[model samples]
Target: MYHDYTEPTWSAQQLLLIALLLVPAVGALLVALLPATRSRLVAVSFAAVTFVLSVLPALIRPADFGWFAYTPLDSAPVPPWIDLDLPWVPALGLEFHLGVDGVSYPLIVLTGLLTLLCCAYTPAKGLAALLLVLEVGVLGTFLALDLILFFLFFEVVLLPMYAVIAGWGGPNRRAAARKFVLYTLAGSVLLLLGVLLVVTKAGTGDLVLLAASPPLDRTTQYTAFALLAVAFAVKAPLWPLHTWLPDAHTEAPTVGSVILAGVLLKMGTYGLIRVGLSVAPDGAAWASPVLGVLAVVAIIAGALICLRQTELKRLIAYSSVGHMGFVLLGIATLSVAGIQAALLGNVAHGLITGLLFFLAGTIKDRAGTGSLNQLSGLRETAPRLAALLGFAAIASLGLPGLAGFWGEAFAVIAAVDRGGPFWTTLAAVAAVGGALTAAYFLRLLRRVTHGPATPEVRSVRPAITATEWLAWSPLILLTLAVGIAPALVLSDTALPLATLLGIQP
Candidate 1:
């Protein structure tokens, strides 16, 4: 092993990037050791640093024609912004590889932003440290280039999120946490097995190598893809697997719900595109129809569930299932347009749903409830809050001028343009689901914000806190910005996605 292994070299930039990755974990440790009173300040300070590091790569990496394109060299599919390649286990051919590209850069920035916002919005409680820890996992998952490394980062997200829910959540937090653990654990088992299968067959755990020169044969790819699908779907929480999401979101504290929807759930769909499809195209193509069908069902089913929900938080939670459905449908198409749509949808949902959760939490805190039935006449009692909520709802419903529209519109276009009987049918069904989404949101708005104020609402003053405004403004502005100029995201993603899927560049 020693004879074959060579010590890896790192440049200053690579070392600095690695340091940035370690900052959150190091900060978490420091925060954990500090007095609880000072933890929030320290966490936020560290989060700000981490956020700067996250955005640095985009500036450092040159882009041509608005797309972050890289010529593959030494068999690397796309030149990672800062590839840290070093042998970890020579016998197994595993390396301590980390990097980021167009596909992951946006999400890394998102993780940083959301983490900072979470810290800012909440009191200087013990929760800030945990959020930082979760950030480490989320960012690492986006950056990891080794399959084993990716899996480790992916699992790191579980404990902190569970703690957040169980420790800070509402009445049903315990049960929700348990359900979340059970589902994710079950999914992880399958995912772990899949990783093993791929690595064993490929004889290496490096994601870059696996994609550049697929080592697994078609049969093995199919088996691994199937296993990975179950795991990712559970996290994506598609339709039947999505039961845990509503409970977790409804019970979780505001920041918990925001991060869960904004950053955590995207992990699953992102994994599908990055690992599932890139590593196993044949399997993905074979499974696309099934995936597409479930996606459409999730869209329709999630909307249908929301329509009947009496609780505001739970309804919004259910709405995520529907919103994520569009992301999944886009991935199933396996076309460049489809994957780009998925990526755009991911960011849009993060902005839209995160804002919704933040607002919902504010309403609950102010009026002492999250029940739509009791949340009447917000427009009359709290016009500003109602306006914000209304705008977020419209964005979520895929209004023409909102960020949500591009994702849904492109997903349908990808499906229809794929031009098979099955895909065309998926597009039609999803179009129907889009209408249902509008219906539920309209119903939600009419019930919660437009009606006459109830006695309870009248008693409580729904003043928007400075913290709420501070935390929500970025999300609100981004939703509008992305809506007006989707090219901000799409341009960067196009070449990379096409490269990943073997589409024409």
Candidate 2:
């Protein structure tokens, strides 16, 4: 069910949604055309406005007759707080349909905030412009309710990100960018096929309608889910499909990595919940066991890989695999608790990992190396940077009373809640993986911040920049805020998850 805003045709909410997409988009073009010196100001201003707009949807209370009001148990599964539907391609049976709800609103806000930070932090006009363009793609992906529109927005992110990596990255960036594009393009092909399959079979491309009452048969659902799952898994970069990630992270620039880890990867998990399970319940159930097994494998494998990594960025990159594994595990459970954990985990990972990448980039820039062994006793030289790194690492390790704890700890709990021999065992192994996460992070802290200061550390500047503080402070604060009160992300999610899982709210 959608909110039937009783306001006039061009309502405030409608314009707000339009501005959310349009502002950054126009900003990108303006930033590109403007003088190099003014680009940062223009980009940040657009991103700031976009971020502010992103939050308003959550505050707009539904009317008495809206979806949020008391309704029967058979309410629409994919209800949006605000939705806009307009004709696009009649020949393709596609409409320009977009909506937002608890499931996507958090991610939208996250994308906006991170992009704003990245734009502010980057000095290059081209990079800042690309970040804004990337923001538009990500926000559009979260907001799109039409299958074709979703796919279009999904593809829009690819080239700009490719340019970011290849244009401003470490050595061997070309190979990494090529791999990233080729790998994700393969997934995109699969995604297009899946979307077309669903549309052809169901004769419509509207996700809200399909999710509310799936028109596909069991076999169709199975095929659709399989295609969609692999496609999203590649983006999620689940386990073996994740080969592209560490390379991308290691080679990409600071802002690129932040966006890539922060909210870009989220498109996968969000798609899994929104498209995979919703469109094919039976297929998801059929595939749950396999998904569960792979998720646990990713958890253990990613953690174990992180322990052996020598480069700081590479280590942090691999850790995302492990963290995302927990998210996939939660989704595999297909319970209300499991999905909610996934959502919370998604937001948590974005905040904590984005900060980690930012800190890592700063440290590497100051010390002139990201090698864990070569860099030691950072606290002796750059206490502020080291302290921030320590905080981010601790948070990434899932320390309680921080943002990272809820998603990971509860993924295990949700698995236990799932309660079968296989699930129980998977839960146990995932718990072990969590232990490994802590071990590696402790090792990282010990290696980088605890020992005697090296020559590189000695030469490093101790002061933290105002720009760095402006970029990182929100992530640090939000990590604690969401950790202390999980409700910040989970508040609007319950009804949506319950509805998606076919459980009573």
Lowest summed lDDT across 10 adjacent residues in model 1 is found at: 1-10
> Tens-digit lDDT track for model 1 on 313-425?
99999999999999999999999988889999999999999999998998888889888888898888889998999999999999987899999999999999989798999
RMSD in angstroms between candidate 1 and the native structure over all alpha carbons? 3.3
lDDT of each: 0.86, 0.90
Model 2: lowest-lDDT 10 consecutive positions = 64-73
Against the true structure, what is each candidate's TM-score? 0.95, 0.97
Residue lDDT tens for model 2, 1-505:
5534464433677777888889999999999999998999999999999999999887774643242333533454546777788888877667998888888989999999999999999989999999999999999999998889999999999999999999999998999999999999999999999999999998988888877778889999999999999999999889889999999999999999999999999999999998898788888999999999999999999999999999999999999999999999999999888998999999999999999999999889888999998889998888888889999999999999999999999989999988878889999999999999999999999999988999988889998889999999999999999999998888667777766666776
Q: Deviation in angstroms for 466 in model 1?
A: 1.7
Return the top candidate by TM-score.
2
For residue 56, give model 2's deviation from the true position in Å.
Answer: 0.8
